[model samples]
Target chain A: MQLARKLAAKLVTGLVMIWVVATATFFLVLEMPGNPALAQEAADMQHGMSPAQAASATAVMFGFVPKQPLPDQYRHYLWQLLHFNLGVSIAEEGVPVSHIVASAAPWTVILASFGIIFSFLIGVTLGILTAIRRTTRLADGLTLLGAFINGVPVFVIAIMLVFVFATILAIFPQGGTVSVLETPGWNAGYLGSLVVHAVLPVACYTLAGLGAWQLTSKSSVITVLGDDFILAAELRGLRPLTLARYVARNAMLPLFTILAISFGLMFSGAVFIEEVFNYPGLGELLIASITTKDFPVLDGAFLLIIVAVILANILADLAYPLIDPRIRRS
Target chain B: MTRLARQPGPDPAGSAAAVEAAPDSVLAPDRGALGDGDAAVRVRDLTVSFPTADGPLPAVAGVSLDLARSHITGLVGESGSGKSTLALTLLNAVPPPGHVDGGSVTIEGVGDVLALHGADLRKMRGAEIGYVFQASQNSLNPLKPVGKQLLDLGRSHGERDQRVLLRRARALFDEMGMDAARVLASYQHELSGGMRQRVGIAFALLLNAHVVILDEPTTALDMLTQALVLEIIRKVHATRHLTTLVISHDVGVIGDLADRMAVMYAGRIVEEGPTVQVLAGPRHPYTRGLLTAMPRIAGDVSEARPLPGRPPDLASIPRQGCVFRPRCPLATRACAEAEPPVTVTGEHRFACFVAAQEVS
Candidate 1:
């Protein structure tokens, strides 16, 4: 009953957060100088229509032009959102914003999931090893390496990796999710292309994320190692494996929440990584919509990312009690 | 029972004076010549030291003791007196930056405990000598249930039949007057202080370790709880027929529970005798001062005077002569010149120049 109440509270808070973000983005996007109607007006004027004709034509074509009052536009947008109707993209000429977002969401999710999972595994393992062998020179070297990797920006690493592997070595493809010629299906050939295409972006994500996890986990384990319970465990003559389990489980508690939040961040997409690799993920879609002044698609994309982040936070809060009973008691 | 002479030559200046007066010094007690033959554990010339910025300083300096079979030996001292360090040395587990400089801890069935390493040392710790650490509340893993930790302990010791091990644990908890199943299901935080202390004792004896040590078992408990826990300890120690050592700073706790008691000051045992004899007639000035300072039920509350001067830490402890010379009311020029010798009288032994001369 307590758990159910806690989860319900977190979910309600998450909904409130989504609404706040949507309202803020709504006003902020409208306040920007350009809109799809203006861009259309410019295009029609370039086609030799008079200014008056283009303005009237835009007004007729786009029923909800920027000229409409702010309150009415807001009410209409909220009504559409409530009905789960992200209206058709003005830039895409009748493609629904929701359809565009749905199509683009999967690529980013898979990439981020792979990156976060792989980094978490490698970081946690290395962190444990480093903490156990803390006094040794090798552990010191690993600490220094983790710090260095953490200090360097992700884009720098991505560019260097692209330059070395794709540009110079010519070992992997430079851009795109898959070859244009391959029939997209569950066939071996198609699947192989997908894996090959994903390698660099995934590698970039892992490399970018690995350092922070290693550093956090290393310090966390070191702290637990000094706990009085650990000393008591040692006195009990516990086997190395059993002792490691106690240390690892306790050390992993703080990291679990961070991992969930990182998973949430996956929807926002790694703009630099996706851009560098020319990967057709949500980040690329977001950038395209932004450049074209496609207000509907941009709003839809923002809403999708915000909802994912909020939901992930709720999941983390709910799952905490399962792993740590100390939290459950409170 | 065995007698331990302070090992000589820790300091060059003090060694010459000590050697010259060796015959009349009364420092050396006849080794294994006058006490009980069946000692469960014999500690000989044990000296543990810790490294500091200046140099290595002894925490448990040149100490020797015996835990007679099936008897509770209480070691009493202020914090930092090294009574706890001496207990850890019995298990050969002095924390790092501090180590056993020299010692031989011999148990009945097991040879020199300090010599055992790796698996042998580990096996001996929880199997032969169970240690109930100070602040039993913090000694338990916070995350795991008590039952899970018990199973971990059993598995670590290569116990093939976990069922038997758990049955022993449950029985031990039951004997300690707890609802065994409920306690086993609960985490450390779920239990009260007294309950945790009892659990500590239960864990110590669960593996059938005949030799048990409880370090400040009732330190943080309320007076009523302390009395109850002390009773439980007495009951458990009796039923198990276990050789036990209880370490505490509170003289009242030791006076109430221990059969034999040793008084420690600055990493040295200043006095050792039957608990009743020592309480009734303490020889060393520090022990006398401690007894005088204790708040007794019968005595005038105003008569209790806290010992003058703080207890000496490793850095502050004197380099030569008696460690208690500065605080001793009967200090003389002779007392400041060299260390006092051990003056043995039947089962009681003490190291004090004035006390020995007075006895003579």
Candidate 2:
């Protein structure tokens, strides 16, 4: 019953977001002064040749056909979206935007999956520990450490790790997933290298995320401490350690919503991490698309991320009923 | 059989003596170690204080009680009576900002409960000593089925097979007037107010707990449910021979269940004695006032009277003085200054300095 309401609410919120973002994308693209024409103008200024033919060619490059009205362009844009036809990338020399994203998407997905799983495991455990030892020197020390790591930006941490491992230690490769000779294959050695190369980036993201996880856990413990259910558990003569685990576990119901946000945010710093590791991911495609103004690829990447977030939120909403009774028949 | 002496009153000692005669139940002389009152639990010179914004607020102010086995003792008081505080001292489960500064919770055949900790205390809980909270909602785990909760309570002290657990749970439900199967399967939120209280009691009694400290078990229930739960408690007590400590602010409610009743004002035990003795002929002014205030449902419509004033603000009470003196109707210059120790006779105890004079 609750799942249905949550899904409905989530769907409405998602649709509203999609509408606003789609509208913003339309206006922002329109707001850009001269797209391919400016590129053509700049090219012409650089070279002595008149490049007048390139001006019309450049207009075609931006998917704006000759003399099309603004409404006509928007209609075409919607049609392309309906058909899932992300038009050819300008910078990638006519390569379809879908292929470019798909090719790089796997690596980014793998890295993010590992990072998310690792963060939940270690971060949540530390959070539980922090909560159990609450107000003690140990809890205080852990909070300080978690806060320090979480306070720092992911990019800064990634770079620092890169310097320490690649530059100073020289035990690991500086960038990319595989050796030049190995190329990309399913071989054990090559797979190991890919995982090894991905380690620093994953650690960087997970470590940066620990602060919030710990804080959430501590607050959850504090919240659960007042619970009549927890007191009930104590009166049942549950071992103290067992009782604490119950507190930490039950308190994670609300935290699960935030965990879903973390799921959505898994790829948030993908652009930065992918750059550091040289892993061929959607982040690279996104970066290139932004710099070269590859509108199809840019729109597709942004839209995909927004959709994933919507999906994550919906999943969280459904799971809430199963976790908390107040929200169940609630 | 011999009846205890009664102090003379204007109504005549002979007429009062006729009313004071014991029922047929007392015809048989009680036996065992408990017959002579070797205090199953002795709490002496216990003074617990909680720190407030201003200074330390005394909760169990030099309180004492001798709970003999095979008997029911009532700890009564209005809201802030410190009756609950006196009850908690027995378990040593006092939370932050409060501590047992000058007292010991000792049990006969068992060691001092206050001295025991870690495994010793944990073992004592739900085994020999059971605790029931005022709110049944606070006692039962919301997420779990009642059967599982009952089984867990037993798991602490002794092992109970699933069969035994299920059997006890069914018996408990049957005793409480609930459907055994449905109640055992149901969650805390699923049960009605009365059903939840039944479940709480079943959990406490599953281990056949020797010392059951019930802290106002019927506070959250409606009048009908309160009477029903109280009836179940009375039945369970006679059947199990459980040493029960029932806490309540209402004098009549305690009057219904407790064999002996103790009246607490602020943090001090103003009066405590045999239930009928205290109720019919209360010695302390506070106890008398509390009994006088009880509204007679069927007779003497205008007899009910409210106490003259509110209780004193607990935080501002002086370091060493009678806690109730500020509002005590019989308070004299002597009562205002020095706190009177609890004067005891047999099982009856009252703290008022004017108790003897009032009775005479």
Model 1, runs deviating above 4 Å: A1-3, A42-63, B1-25, B29-36
Separate DockQ for every predicted complex: 0.65, 0.37
Whose DockQ is greatest here?
Answer: 1
Backbone clash total, candidate 1: 2
Q: For residues B1-360, could you state the per-residue lDDT of candidate 2 as single tens digits?
A: 000121111222222324453332211111111222335566666788888887777887777675756578888888876887787778777665688888667664445777778877776677666778766555665555677766666665567587887787798778778899998788777778777777777877776666777878888799999999899988887777777888888777888888888888878777777899888878788888888888898868588988888865577554566667766787877776777655544455676777755533
- TM-score of the first chain of model 2: 0.87
Candidate 1 is scored at a TM of: 0.92
Alpha carbon lDDT of each predicted model = 0.84, 0.72
Model 1 chain B: ten consecutive residues of lowest lDDT: B1-10
Residue-wise lDDT of candidate 1 within A1-330, one digit each (tens)?
877887788888888888899989988877777777988889999999998888888766654555668998899888888899877777777778888999989999888999899988998888888898998999999999988988999889889889998999988888799987789999888888899889999999899999899999999999999988887787878887888899889998999999999998897858788889998889888888888877888899999999988888888888888889887777
Tens digit per residue, CA lDDT, model 2, A194-302: 7778788778767777777878777887878877667655554666765765676578877889888778755545788787777777787778767777766777777
Q: Which candidate's TM-score is highest?
A: 1
Clashing pairs for model 1 are B1-B36, B27-B342
